[model samples]
Target chain A: MLLFLLAAAVAVAASLAVVLGRNPMHSVLLLIVSFAALAALYIGLDAPFAAVVQIIIYAGAIMVLFLFVVMLLNAHREDEGTGGAALGGRPLAAGAALAIVLAAELAWAVLRTRRAGGSWMGAGPESDGTALQSVRTLGGVLYSEYSLAFEVTSLLIIVAMVGAVVLARRES
Target chain B: MSSVSTIGQALNGIVPVMCVTLAGIACMLAEAFRRRGERMPIGGLGLVGLAGAGASAVLLWGRRAGCLGVAEADDFGLFVQLVLVGIGVLTIVFSSDAVEREGLPAGEYYALTMFALAGMMLMAVATDLLVIFLALEVFSLALYAMTGLRRRVYASAEGAFKYFILGGFSSAFFLYGVAFAFGLSGSTHLDRLAAHVQAHAPAGGLLLLVAMGLLLAGFAFKVAAVPFHMWTPDAYESAPTVVTGFMSTAVKAAAFAAFIRVFLHALGPLRADWLPVVWVLAICTMILGSVVGVVQVNLKRMLAYSSIAHGGYLLVALASGDEVGRAAILFYLVVYAVTNVGAFAVIALLDSREAPMQTLDDYRGLWHRSPFMSGMLAVFLLSLGGFPPFAGFVAKWYVFTAAVRADQYALAIVGVLTSVVSVFFYLRIIVMMYMTDKAAEAAPAALPRVPKPAAAALWLSVAALLYLGVLPTRVVEIAARAVASVL
Candidate 1:
């Protein structure tokens, strides 16, 4: 648990460093670290399926696309002018908002935990066997109790597919 | 696995989407198989597919709720789906000429459009957070690609890049919010979340608020509200005019549909906590969107700002959070969609080539060049400006009245003030059209003939605007019932 917390903190700091870093490529690498950390957090939350999916889809696929595009576009921070530092002033505003959010989250966590009295019961002990079993159960519930969502998910994939094609078509 | 038992139920929910997916595939095949010398099958198959989707949406209306693992279907989802499908049809009709002019492959354009429409329908009808996220990506990725469709134009490429980056960032925030909600409530279903929020009440505190706020920020960006609106102008201006038309209408509607669903259903009990945040968003969107529009020389950029204002007005209805408020949103969406599309169609016709004639100066002496087209543009613009005896005014009236009825009188006042402020920009174009003299060669060198199908869309939009504006009672009654049934 201590290792996980430390890793998560390191990941968040790396991500901030990436955003604040002067080099775009360095920032990209930092974002990858952030995504990796998020995946770990998802795993620790007992949603290994989501964690793996996040790594594959977001970290592996989407970020690669972003990198390819950024490199192909050959964008340089120098070309963009150091307009980013001025954005730092806005950071104070962002920090205030973040503080409020953190306060609210802390309060909710305390209250909900107090209300539940630390009940860590899973939905059912019978399904507490394996990650595979959890995935199977998730799929089962997704289709049986949540099939409408499944269909919508399929539709979403279709839209993304088409969106890619349409948006990428060559000009006449 | 629960696969076998739910297959039947799943198939039931899948048919409508399947029809579109199959049609898109068929269009691709036809495009590939066609003879080299022959014209591509542009209008027929794509139109038919969208038409079929629309028909199926109606056919499946009220059949049963919760066929598979989905939450359920109801009047609200059905109504929103109908609106989305209708906008899809309109977009295709309006784009027929514009696409051809730009030398875009009709097959890819039509397929993506159908796919995006399918995603939107899914989004409007979805009750699951996971499904919503997927649907968002489906449509957004499609839009991002479409924004960069004109690849040689560096501007389009830049705009697409911006949209993709920001869109991806927002999606991440949205996913984190969903994760928090699932962590807190143990289920991502709207009904379940509502129950949890109600049970927990004020004590649910920061976690729930964070979840809701993150979600709000995500939707605010999608809907192009003030602070999150940096991407709208550039993306809209750079994308093909037809793509912009579709994005502004169909995409905006889908986003708002999901927005209202989440707020009204999942987060209702925590209204007091989030209401102030939304109130500020509403005011900023209205003020900035309207005031900023006045300075835009580029017509597309101007319309982009106006869209932000429209989003603000919709926010007012959402913040009001009443049956009437909900109904007002639905009605306003329909009217706004029609009027905005009509305006864009006119803009598309006013320009000759892929190069945009969007500057305010270019519109001078438009009245003398094409009387009918200019007049049509006037009607649509007037409606958008909230001018009376036109649909825009009536839609505004309904939304403001709904706000007042909900005891959100201050919001109503702000809305009205913004509407009046917005008129200046809308009239700026009208005055340029009618009052100014045609500067030598100020008008477009040549006006393309308004194709019959495109004309039909414009006429329909104008007729709907006037019809709904004059007699909103029937539509309002229907909208009210639709919203009430969902709640």
Candidate 2:
């Protein structure tokens, strides 16, 4: 419980900093921190595979790409005075209201699940508490049951690569 | 030996897609090895592959084969596969001239097109949500690149950017819906989902509804149904005309194939909950598509809206939710694909780098400039307007009949009314082509001759439209049998 709270708090704080940071570089770095905290939360929920993927993909590879893009674009601190007043006047209020409503709905759902004693944290038929996060089981299922999708994902990636080359290549 | 035989069975289900993929690879290799500025008949290679796919699909008809539990080559899927192959062949044929005219890289153009067609064919046949999503991404990525293939053109880039961002957003929505569905039923297979829904009808409740709605949003975006169709006009308008034809028809056909399977087959039990929502969507799409289309002057943009309204018609068929409705969808997809591709092929043939003709005024007195081109365009336009003795009329007639048979009078009425409104725009184009005199000062110095291949394809498409219109019973029976295999 304590670990969960700690990870959750760190995630929330880092995410808030990510949104609030003026410098684009600082925001990206903060997002990595938020992603790490989320990974920790995932670990607390007994999803080690998801947690590892979250750290590797989101915090490591994706963040590096983000940093490269930020550097390439030479992004700087956002100007606060440009359109702040106009955005904050009505749209901000409505956005905040909607956010509050969404948060409330999420909280109510979680509370209801807790009251019902439902295992909202990976307690389905396949969970079994142990083998759920095992890479061996995952590989077996992926190769046997989900092989078609796994193979097709390779085709999807090839298409994406070809598309990138097509769109980004010089017109010589 | 048994394992090998099982593998062979799996391979059998995907032979058509594999043929196309191999051709795409061959195109890539040819592109890499070719000398700079050396013209290659890459489109011919694509045609061979498409022909192979079509032949294989014909062979696979009525087989109902499954691949590794995720993909299936059911008759319904094979029928759509044949249509996609036809669209691909026509696109490649039409693109033979446009490729050089527009200075598009031939290898990338044909390769990407082959890959996109393969992905579309896979989408039609996939029985698992994850596979469908992957297939969607494959084609969508290829299409986004194709849309921006003219990298120097600002509108092309802008349109591609909008399509990519919006397409990514919809894909995320689709993945989310898949997750929700998995959460509810603990499986993503269509048959499993159907069984789960059958067992837990009305009990899965809100989450099931949310899943259905999200999935519908993804498909609606692909089909360019209203409220999710903001990206259609811009993307269609900016893409190379031949590409616009391919995506507008093939994508919708593939997406509709999956949409019908998922919504009306797997989630059919929850029809009471979803039917009213689809009814609302169908009405809105028809009204908005026709009304907004009436104001568009750009030929491609006008067709984009017309496609959206056609999507509305398909949605009406979906709402009807019967075997007749399913069969109507199959028939309509074929008719719409041939006719729309033929129309866009005309636009491509008429377009010249020096004189880029796209506007309504550009079409004025086109009959005087090139009588054959004008005549072909008139046939396409009249067919689009759902005139008698054309494919579009029969397609729309089947859709309306399906709706009426299902007791969806309001949807049928709205569909008929909006189609009537849409016909005005189609006729407006035909009128401009035939009636208005070309201003002497604005006359093009020289109109490009229609490439022989494109001209031949146009003639074939027109012949098809006439055949389907005048003697529709045979194809209608085949379509009915196709849907029967699935339902």
Candidate 3:
């Protein structure tokens, strides 16, 4: 319980910092910290495979790409003149109101589930006897049960590749 | 041995999609090996593939096959697949001239079209949300590229960028909804989701509603229902006219197919919950589409709004949630696809490199230049306005009847009123074509000659529409049977 609370707090704080940071580089680094906190939460939920993937794929690889883009674009700190002032009027107020309403509704749902003696969190793989977190089991399921989707994903990738070539290639 | 047999069975359900995918691959190979300045009939390859897909889809009818528990080859899917194949064949036929005239990359154009057709076919048959999402992305990516095929045109690039960004947001929303569905039911298959809904009726209340709302929003974006329709006009106007036709017709047909299957078949027990929401959407879409369409001077934007209105009519049919409504959707899709594609083909034929004729003013005195083309456009526009003796009238009639049958009297009334209001814009275009004359000094060079293939395709579309409008009973019966298989 203590670990869950600690990881959740870290995640919340880091996510807020990522959004609120002035500098693009600081934002990217804060996002990595937020991703690490999410991995820790995944570990607390007994999903070691998910936690490791969260760390490797999101925190390590995607964040590096984000950093590269930031540097390449030469992005700087948010301009004080346009940063908050641009969204300072009615749109901002409406956006905040909508966000608050959405958050409250989500909180109510979680509380309702808890009050009804239902776990808001998902069941661990041990309860299902499937070892779902293991890469081998995931592969087995992907091949056997969801094989059509797996194959279709290959088609999707081919289309993306073709599209990239079509859009990015220099015309002769 | 059992696994091998299972694989063979799974393959049987997807032969049509495979044919198109293979054709796409072949087109790519041919492009790579082509001489620098050689002209290839790559579009012919697409037609051959579509023919094979049509044949396979016909064979799969009544078989009731399942592919790896994710896609099903029911008569409903086969019917939509036949429509998609027809759309693909016509698009390829019409694109041949447009490709050369506009200097488009012919190989990439036909290949991307085939891939998009394949994705559309998969979406029609997919029974699993995950497969549906993948299929959606496959086609959307291909279309975004196709929209920007005119690399030198700033408008094309801008449209593609807007569509891609908005499309990504919708896909994320859809995936989030799928996640919520999985979390609630522990499965992504429609049958399993239906079973879960049945087992936990009142228990899955708020979360279930959220899932449905999110899914509906995703579909509404794809179908261009009002309030989520900001992307349609710009995207439609900026794309090559033929592409605009394909997007308006085939994409809507595939998306509607999945929407019907997921909502009417899977979450059917909660019809009462979603009916009111769809009801409101239908009304708003009808009103906004018709009203905004009146002020547009650009023909493409006008037709874009018209297509959104047509989507509204389809949503009215969907909200009915009855057998008649389901069958009406199939019949309406067939008629609308033929008529809309014909109209866009005319616009494409009139367009040239030096004078890309698109605005309402450009269409003025078109009858004096080419009587046949103007007459064809008149017919298509009249049909779109739901005139009798044309396919669109019958389609709208059936849709409104479905609403009336479901006791949605207000929806039917609004539908009828909007059809009347929307006819004004269609007639305005017709007036520009025949009634008004181009000023002596303002007349441009002589119009380009209509190519034989495109003219033939237009004739086919017109004939089909007249036949369906006059004698809709046979097709209506077929549509009924198709809906019966799934619903």
Candidate 4:
């Protein structure tokens, strides 16, 4: 539980760094840290498969692509450095809105004792509703009940594959 | 006999999905075999496939009412399918000219479109979280590739990269949420989750709320809601105008349809829990979408923000959690789709080699240069602004009424105010065309001839907008039936 809290804090902090950092490369790196910490939270939720996949696909592959673009485009230096933050004052306002949301949620947690009335102090079942077992269970459900949706998913992947090839290839 | 029956049942269950898949494959094969400069035939074949899917959807509609499967095919899904297929048809019409100009592989374009449409259709019917994730990625991947089709243009390629990266990030959040929901609910089937939610209603846990929040974030990105909407303007600005038209309408429709299904069915029991969250989103989306759009000089970027705001309006309808609200969303979606695509179709036609001409300054004195184009554009812009006797006005009326009906009067009032704010931007274009003389000489002089197919699409869009505006009762009735049938 403490580890989960620590990871959440780190993720939150890293997210702030990613948004507030002036350097594009630094922002990208902070995003990677945030992704890793999120993976830890996924693991804490008992979704090992998802945790592993998140780390591998998101932290490893996707973030590398972002870093690659940052490097390749050399956008880090040319990102209109000083005025980028001032392009809109909305982000700071968005942060305040998010804080309000958090406060509202916290207040609801404190006031609401209608049924399973108690403090949310890790006092009950650790089942986060969708655990790793649920993922495995979903696989079974996808095969047996939603098999068609599964096949459609595969077809979509194939189409995406072909599309990427066609789009990226040079004119013949 | 039992095996045969089982196979038959399986095929029956998979028909809607199969329709799109088979059509996409046919388009792919046709593309492979087609020769150069004979791309028209390929485009025609792809349209035939999408039309067939639409026909199949019509054929199978209401026939699978109680049939057991991984997903359900009801009137709601069929409505979404029809809308998506219609968009696909319009997309071809809109892209034909642009495709010719760019010298793209027509085969790939048609095939990717079909594939994306298929994913969208699947999303509408998907009853499982994993299926939803997969379907979302399917469309997202196709869009990423399509956005980069003009690879020689550095901005286009960069836009694709940004969309791809951000899309992957959001997909990860979706999957994580799915994991959390599965952990808490002990299942991923939306129906089963609903049942579980009801069983544990009073015993609500942070786990369910967290799962819901994550899922919301994922969809927030998909719908391009504020905060998660950072990628939209860049992407829309950089992509080909025709592609932008298709993406803005088709993708938004599919994502929002899935969103409605998940929230209304799976989380229906948790209405009290999520309603407030959605309320805030709705307000933020509307205000930001309208206000920011006014400041954008770039036409595509302005429209992108407009799309974000529209998504918020739809969210407001969804937040209402009433039968009237659901039906209003569908009605509003249809109206919005026609007006938006019509607007884009005109914009696509106006582009030239020297510059894209998407800025308001470039549009100055457009009426003097090409009356027919500017006139059509004025109608679309007015419709977008919710002017009287136009579809946008009716759509907004329905949505806001739904909000009022649900007792979210504050939201409804805010919706009205933001809508008023939105009018300024929509009118800005009109004002540029009529009132300004800033670029009268600079504006292109000759109006272009409309291709037969594109003309059909444009006319149909205008007709639909007019028909829906003047007499929306019938469509509203159908929308009500569709929503009720699903619920």
TM-score of each prediction: 0.79, 0.84, 0.84, 0.78
Native contacts retained per candidate? Answer: 0.87, 0.89, 0.81, 0.64
Most accurate candidate by TM-score = 2
Measured against the true two-chain complex, the DockQ scores of the candidates, in the order shown, are: 0.39, 0.62, 0.58, 0.37
Instruction: Specify the CAPRI tier of model 2.
Output: medium
> What order do you get sorting by DockQ, best first?
2, 3, 1, 4
Among all windows of 10 consecutive residues in model 4 chain B, the one with the lowest summed lDDT is B438-447
lDDT of 3 at B194: 91
Residue-level lDDT tens digits of model 1 in B224-299: 9989999999999988888888898887888988898888888877788888999999999999999999889899
Evaluation by DockQ, superior candidate among 2 and 3? 2
Please say which candidate is ahead in TM-score: 1 or 3.
3
B419 Cα displacement, candidate 3 (Å)? 0.6
lDDT of 4 by residue, A50-96 (tens): 88789879999798889878876877654564564656778778978
Docking class of 1: acceptable
RMSD of model 2 against the true structure: 7.4
Best-first order by lDDT = 3, 2, 4, 1
TM-score of chain B of each: 0.95, 0.98, 0.98, 0.96
Better candidate by DockQ, 1 or 2: 2
Superposed Cα deviation of residue A14, candidate 3 (Å): 26
For B1-487, candidate 4 gives per-residue lDDT tens digits of 9998877665663465566667677778887777755634667766777878788788877765322455677788778878888888888878888787766667777778778887888888777787788888888888888888886688998898899999999999999999999998877888878888889895569898889999989998998888788899899988888889889988888888889888888888888988888888888889999999989999999999888889888988998878889999888888878888888888888875654567878888877777877888888889988997989999988889889988999899989999899889998899989997756354354555667778777777888888999999998998888878667
